[model samples]
Target: MTRIVLLGGGVGGSMVSNQLARQLKPEILRGEVEITVINESDTHVYQPYFLYMAFDQAVPADAKRPERAVLNNQIKLVVGHAERVDREAKDVVMGDGAHIPYDYLVIATGSRPAPETVPGLVEGGHIFYTEEGALKLRDALAEFTGGRVLVTVGVPHKCPVAPVEFTLMVRDWLDTHGFESSEVLYTYPIGRLHSLEPVAAWATEIFDQRRIDSRTFFNVETVDSEKKTVTTLEGDTVSYDLLVAIPPHLGQDIVKRSGLGDAGNWIATDRHSLLMQGTDNIYVLGDATNLPISKAGSTAHFQADVVSSNLVNRIHGGLGSVRYDGKVFCFIEAGNDEATYVKFDYQHPPKPQPPTEMIHLYKLAFNKMYWLSAAGIL
Candidate 1:
């Protein structure tokens, strides 16, 4: 059996599993071939609409679909947390006392927020990084009348633009809720408003128009929820009534303990090919990889395409033939009625520019597409 083990059950993992199943032949991949995907969670989240568009508390039910629905029937999906990859033994250690061997291992374990890493954060402040966390905020947002609302990003967060997006959406929501006077602030690690140029221009302009206070170049050292204040590494403190903090992300604990990660515990990989260095027969993708692109779903979708093609070629005894372009598309809400999208393909030498409404429509309807795609209907 050609045993293949895929890690994680997120967007990136599900997409590649579907593609690879279509390529690896039944004769070669039948009983002789075993396809296993190890993931911890039972539900898969459509992360795009975690905020405004799908504001209903019940959205998580619709967002998560069965992992088996996304991949073909030939693949065997296992529900468990992988402790570490034993590259020397070609096996994966599960959180439980079990080991799964694999001919080729694909590490798709994604990133996670570490709010507790910040001083006084877990004990003092509130966050909306996960579904449950945001659900708590949903209740918090409803009962609260109005006060200083802060949306701060810790150093190195996935979906880097999300804090800004959430901030604007909440401001709009608050205004609708008759809290127009409530102070809204945006704090970031970067000097500019948005990390990307086109998006930054659009966001900076929105910051002025919507009155979203922008605080740049400040590193969040600790969050004091009880004191209702946030302290920075630069020894400055800011007060907040409600804090929507984006926590620093780290690679899956499995990869970190396996000694496959960098200083921050994110896995190191080829900048272009998405393959694990010093190890063949292994691939890393999305937020888990050391790719120099935004850790958004669009980036994962594009990376999966490249990894899928490359894995197929490698299986056929051909050379690694796929090259991944550092392409990313981000949709920004203009806060009134329209949205702005930005597209970037690193190969082109042109500077970043504002994207058209086509990207907006694409962004809005992505959840539906995601549901269809994840359900294997696509």
Candidate 2:
């Protein structure tokens, strides 16, 4: 039997496994193939909702579902932490010392925020990346009256557009929640408001129109919790009554332990094939790859199509000629119930459209329809 093992239960892994199961239903029924997903958690959380959760617009229940429910019944689900991937032996070593062998491997372990890397950041600033972080930020917002709200961004974080969306939404929130006196100051590590040139230009226009203050080339060095201030590597200190930070992210520890990734734990992957470099049977996707692209859910969904098709074709003695075109789409919330969207591929740059209430409503609908997406029906 051809055994395929997926080493994570995130969006990419779940989608690919489900797609493969659907496409290879005949092979599986004949005892020709098997698919297994090894994940550390029994629950699958839609992380995008954490942004809304911080603003009290969503709850934890809105973001979470049983991992088994999100996956296909035919796929085996293993809930345990992985120790390391044994590439030479072609198996995954579990923390409990179990060896799961595979004819093919898919690494989708995703990424994690490293707030502790920045001194005093864990104690001084608020982050909405995780469920706990979002709930804490929600409590902080509830108690806040009015002050200088600073939003500092770090490099290589997931959900590239979240910081911008949060800034815009918070500005509107302050106005509607009797905190109109609050000042919002945004900062970026690079020399622009955003990494994408077009996005930077678009966000700059919105910031100016909304009277939001911003600074570029501000690399956070440390935070002084007692003083309520942040110091930048450029030798400048800024005071804030409240601080929201998008912390730097790194790949899974198992990737590093297995020596399958760089110092930052990002695995080298073929852009078109989505396969790990120097390997034919191993594929990498989502935030695990070092590809120079936004680590967003849409990217994972797009890559899933390529990987699943290739895997299915290869199992049928095909050359697996399908290639990923680096397609990505993102909804940019512009506040006041208006939103915009940007769609681009490897050869094209995104041009964000004008904000509209209809687009905002579509984004809300998409949130509710995300379960269908996870089920590989959309």
Model 2 Cα displacement at 305 (Å)?
0.2
Q: What TM-scores do the predictions have?
A: 0.92, 0.99
Candidate 2 lDDT trough over 10 residues, lowest sum? 368-377
Question: Candidate 1 on 217-334: residue-level lDDT in tens?
Answer: 7788887767899888878899988888888888777877888888787777886788898777888888898776788777777888888788777767788768888887767654
Cα TM-score of candidate 2:
0.99
Q: What shift in Å separates residue 32 of candidate 1 from its native position after superposition?
A: 4.8
lDDT agreement with native, every candidate: 0.76, 0.94
The digit string of per-residue lDDT tens for model 2 on 21-58 reads: 99999998999999999999999889989989999999
Error of 1 at 89 (Å): 0.6
Superposition-based RMSD of candidate 1 using all C-alpha atoms, in angstroms: 2.3
Q: List the residue pairs that clash in candidate 2.
A: none
RMSD of each: 2.3, 0.7
